[model samples]
Target: MTLDSETFRALVTEASLSPSVHNTQPTRWRLGPDGRVQVLEDESRRLPVGDPEGRDLNVSHGSAVEGFCLAAGRRGLVVDVGHDGVHVAELTVRLGGVSDPLAAFLTQRRTYRGKFEGGAVAHAAMARFEQSEDLIVAQDPDHVAELARLYDEAGLRWFRNVPYRAELVSWMRLSRRHPSWSLDGLNAEAMEMSGIEATGAGLVLRPGVFETLDRIGLAGALVAEAAVVRSASAVALFHRPANEAPFDTGRRFHRVWLSFTQAGLSAAPMAVLADDTKARESLQADFGIGGERRLITAFRLGVAPARDLAAKPRLGLDALIV
Candidate 1:
């Protein structure tokens, strides 16, 4: 199959569905006159304040590239991918090999932030999962209890900050009347709680809901953590050297993240433990991480439970295409 404008566009459309840090779709793509796809950083989409450097941006790029690779495979194009910078990865796709069976799972994969079926993610599978150098999975219930506390503490610290809260509110897409907001921020429907039908509104912590969320957030994090620990499967934590640029590390982090998704195991990045310094330092001590290596992202993997809420919508190709 030859690379043409329409085919390339279709490939990119499929690729954009991949997950990223904060759901920030930071990767930018351009097609050279020579017919190759060129990807670069759209610094505007970057979370400079929260991410400081472009670490998260890079990881987002990696995730995007992984999506592209999967899309290419589905289209019967074999891809050669590699990094050009903290902000970029160059990809060349050509006709080749059998399509990956997991390629179909890309668009279907979602960051299921609800309950997981109680069970263990087989030891053999867990062992294979640990093979990624930058990843870790915690599936012990006691560990889940500890991790839940960590996630709660992190959320408490994050939501308490006026600027952070403001940023979160800004990204929220509250209603169908305003469609763009859906592109980013946490969707209310995605949160697991009672008395609320899964609605794709912005993270609606209505007045009294804060206390409930406080409990649910803590419990959900614990449940997620325990799911990983109990099923002997929780999530994969990715990291690279601390001195590396944000963009550089992020690219690598997402590559591993999406690979897990393509494997039929659903995952979502959890940077709470990584972003919380005191927590990260303690984790370093516990996980035996040393020598200036730092955590980049973590993902919880498990079977998604069915719910009434609809899947979060994505911006149409026409709007996202540039």
Candidate 2:
């Protein structure tokens, strides 16, 4: 049966909340006459510099598809997703679906970019993650410190790339004055940055200014996240089978993150560790990751301070539906 406009709007709205690379929200939804929902990638929103291969972009779309499925399940609707060339996926919706346990965490999940409170994750939480075949947790303080250093190094390496830096700044809504501040991209408040800090970031990230700082050996220390990474109760490594498609990997990615939410913990992805070639290789070797597995991403797990942070900026439903 065809989904009415109201039901379609609700499903797409929930799906749009899924995380995307640089908050690009690149997926577009189209409802067909036959009632199948088509997921399409908005090529204009792609991160050409940061994600040249579109790997992360595909993953983002995958997560959105999963989000749509979960939203459907919550309403007692089932979605059968299938590969549809020229589109990300074609979803056939039907009734009689069971609600997903993870759906409850969808609205609660946020990327806690601020410093986590001082404490360890609950013992039960740690145990649950340890039992997962796709997760590896590093809790030792010393090991965490080492990983933090590597993460900073990898991040700094990317920061030195002019185009990459520019692309990042383009997606950063550093001030409330930005026209799209509350509509899309990474707004300052959502990043846990104060106005002063956001202003400072805008200046420091300028290519010439950053280069000058780097020449003086100040850039590394200025942008380093060692302290934040060290503050995490544990670092989690998320992996998938080597030959698996990123779309499939992304489906699991959202589930893994929601699992963190279910356990009453907060997390922020340390994507640099998985994105940088050298860093990825180092982590695989150091952590005994089998050759058959690919490290998709990493997250810093901990407790965030209690506060009502601002909502994540997103494009409206009009822009999402084509």
Candidate 3:
């Protein structure tokens, strides 16, 4: 369990792969004087406008911790993990343990942003999730279209809300030329934008552009995003009532993500749906969800692309460790 500085650095790098809101990479770490690795939620990285409830931040932290645990297990270590303070988690890795079979997926998983080819999700891919009461999959084109409509409406709401769009825009790194492009947050390349279209898209992200689109009622929902939603083989929603077992919810949610990745299907978050309260409520009603259950996250799944995706830059472990 003894970790030199370099080993500790490697561990944290692998752990930080868990997705965050806008790729904020909101978690930080510190190699304690006592040898345990302390995982803390970076207060500065909190997205108050985008995630007012802080549930999304906490869920993302849980997912990051899970990734760290999987990596530890893969290295033959038994990990003791727990929360020490608000948004603070502690990890102690001891030698001797069987590796997690899902460990490989920790690196393989990332939100797929490309448009999906046609066809419904295979029946076999879903059979594995039958027992998960909280997961709902929508494969019918009509159902997906309804979800897309909801997604676009949600985007409109975001555009109109100054605080929301401003907060999102700040995190967007327009191109590789931007200094922060590889360090953190959303980089344009990950969206597959290229050439003149890439530069044009960046310009529209400027202030007033979104506002003008909102005022004109242009179909300003991201074209590629809409295409992805419409072409998705299936859309998945994970639901649970508020104030429930939040950590377990995240763990199960991350597991679902990895499971689908292993099965060769890619999952992308329909984050806009959860950010707008009206769209969130309407989605619940449209799907006839019970009164007690509320959707926590929405995603679309499709076949993985033939090539590997470029790695999104993260604030590496050294920088992550406070």
Q: Is candidate 1 or candidate 2 better by lDDT?
A: 2
Query: 114-195 in candidate 1: lDDT tens per residue?
Result: 5556445433355676766676667666775677667656756766555665665555544545556466555544444332
Model 1 C-alpha lDDT versus the unseen true structure? 0.63
Cα-based TM-score, every candidate: 0.78, 0.98, 0.91
Q: Give the distance in Å from residue 157's predicted Cα in candidate 2 to where it truly belongs.
A: 0.5
Candidate 2 lDDT over residue span 1-322, tens digit each: 6777789999999998898888889999999888888899889999988999898999999999999999999999999999868788999999888999999888888998888886545445767898789999998889889999999999999999999999999999999999989988889988888999999999999979999999999999988989999988889999999999999888899999999999989999999999999999999999999899999999998888988777778899999999
Candidate 3 on 246-277: residue-level lDDT in tens? 56566667777888888778888887786678
- Lowest-sum lDDT 10-residue window in model 3: 217-226
Instruction: Note the Cα lDDT for every prediction shown.
Output: 0.63, 0.90, 0.76
- Which residues of candidate 2, in runs, are more than 4 Å off? 120-123
The best-first sequence of candidates by lDDT reads: 2, 3, 1
Among the numbered candidates, top TM-score falls to: 2
Better of 2 and 3 by lDDT: 2
Ten-residue stretch with the least lDDT total in model 1: 193-202
Q: How many clashes would you count in candidate 2?
A: 0
